[model samples]
Target: MYVPVSLLFFFIGTALFVYYKTQPGLLPETVTGDQVFPYFIVNGLPAGFTGLLIAAIFAAGMSTVSTSINSSATVVLTDFFNVTSHSEADEKRKMNILHATSVILGALGVGVGLAMMSVKSALDAWWSMAAIFSGGMLGLFFLGYIARGIKGSYAFVGVICGVLLIAWMSLSRQTVFHNYLTIVLGTLVIFTVGMLLAIAGSRLKKGN
Candidate 1:
């Protein structure tokens, strides 16, 4: 990340970030957002740096929206339809359904994002709330991954627990941990509950 030392520090900082992001995902989730943005801004960056930051912000939002739409649509098409479509003749129909789903979801995300802008900006507690409930999701994957016992019917129970855990964490106003840590704690709790359910399921199966 060294530069000619002759160039302004702002330019050097910009160069270094572009170089860094090019190399794998650089630091963990926290550091990645931090280092580059601050370095360029505090050092009195050029106009281009401001442009880049704005672009990066919008790009992040767009990518998030796109991914959400695509994922939701995929779940509806694959899991929901795969259950009942049992014939070769239905494959073509399913493909059409998937195409329709993708378009509809994409449109919905754009529409909702625009519509919700008023709500998003009006709230002061959004960032705190963001951190408070951030970690509920990682729990689902943890149970669905390491603990082989959690599967099938018991999986839904675990998911419900994850949602409830987030709700409890958010409403309690107990911001003991930062947003990132909140996610880890929430995930851990949900994973434990899910595992217990899976274990009980195993016991019932063995008794039967």
Candidate 2:
């Protein structure tokens, strides 16, 4: 599945590149990533294929939105509500909470979407923001899985450090690496720092 999808993307990208090279005057210098697909659909595709492409785009968007809502609701229920509760809640109550959480999240997502309507490059902005958000999460997961014997306290510290580093890297727009690589750098920082702290703490405890 992954390979096929990747090949599809490669072909599509190559086609787009060829189109742009052949018709440089069609698009402005300030054209964004979001404009590429719509332009292709409107200009490149025939009448018969255009509608199909539009439907496919809508379906893909709907699929992503549905998946995001479902995942958010699951996380809220399992991680936040379930963990905080002392006993098993009533099924009806749980369902209500889940629904409420989904509604709130949907509203928040809409608000954010509206706020970002004027963004120059939606793809770039989305990737950058996603990298920042995923940094601490992926870092902690890596720390736990790879760094055996790391204490929870050290792990927490590592997450904090990783988040701070990510913030600095993002704010400074450091050219040391590309924006997408920030997440990888953040994860490495968290794992390295957490492991070092854990080992140092263990040694200090043994000395005492």
Q: For residues 30-145, could you state the per-residue lDDT of candidate 1 as single tens digits?
A: 54433555554544468887779778878987897778767887798768877766755366777788779988888876785686566533232464455445555677777777
Global lDDT of model 2: 0.84
RMSD of each: 10.4, 2.9
Regions of candidate 1 where Cα sits further than 4 Å from its true position? 1-75, 89-95, 119-137, 141-146, 167-181, 199-208
Worst 10-residue lDDT window, candidate 2: 171-180
Show the lowest summed lDDT stretch of 10 residues, model 1: 119-128
Clashes of 1: 2
Separate clash counts for every candidate: 2, 0
- For residues 128-157, could you state the per-residue lDDT of candidate 2 as single tens digits? 676677779988988888876788899999
CA lDDT of every candidate? 0.66, 0.84
For model 1, what is the alpha-carbon lDDT of residue 17?
A: 70
TM-score, candidate number 1: 0.48
